[model samples]
Target: MRSKPLLRVRKTGALMVAAVIAFVCAVPLAGAMWQLTPVLLIPVVVFVWAWRAGTDVYADELRVRALVGSTRVPWQRVSELAPDAGGQISALLDNGNVIRLTGVTSDNLPRVLAAGGQQIGHSDQPPS
Candidate 1:
């Protein structure tokens, strides 16, 4: 039997907060310093990144999203998964690249693993 689809990772909350902070700082400055309106690009870029960037874990692969597109890494390419110092989950790929999962944390690592088809064997489930 197939399991339900993996839920999307949670990064939108941070995006909303970042958008608000960016506008608050950029608008007044842009109004007062018309010539420096270009400076607002910095915050605008950050807001766009926050809105566009995210990671999605699937049964067979991991998807990393960006403003314009996304990249998919199959489970076979995943060599390691662990929590980093800042609490984000990081993956070491067989290609020797380490990618930080945008919305995943240590606390949610087990869930992500299960969604990726790792046998988590939770005690709460009855043994087959």
Candidate 2:
């Protein structure tokens, strides 16, 4: 079967919070007669960060393109799949790298695990 995205989620709350903090930080500088050019980048950075927070897991490849960078793991390289207590699903690779999937829903977790050719375990927590 072709790999498909089981879930897509962004950190909207965190982004908004970051934007607010950036704005607040800029206000003081703006009042001090200082240019707020640097501060303006904060909101943009926050937006980019939020936009990249989404996770994608497919049958043949598991990809995560977050603030750090993007990684594509072929199914054959996946050693195990585990869900943490916080509802984040982690794909453990044969190379010992773990890609955590956030913002996944309970309904989609089953399909993702199945696509990865792994069975869900008792400790597996449904995605949030």
lDDT of 1 by residue, 1-128 (tens): 63444846767677768777887888888999799888788877777777767777788888877767877888888888878788998888998999888778888888788887876434667778
Candidate 2, residue 5: the lDDT equals 72
Estimate candidate 2's alpha-carbon lDDT, on a 0 to 1 scale.
0.69
Please, what is the TM-score per model? 0.74, 0.61
Each prediction's total of clashing residue pairs, residues at least 3 apart in sequence or on different chains, is 0, 1
Candidate 1: misplaced stretches above 4 Å?
A: 1-5, 67-69, 120-128
lDDT of 2 by residue, 74-97 (tens): 878877767787766777889998
RMSD of each: 6.3, 5.9
62 Cα displacement, candidate 1 (Å): 0.3
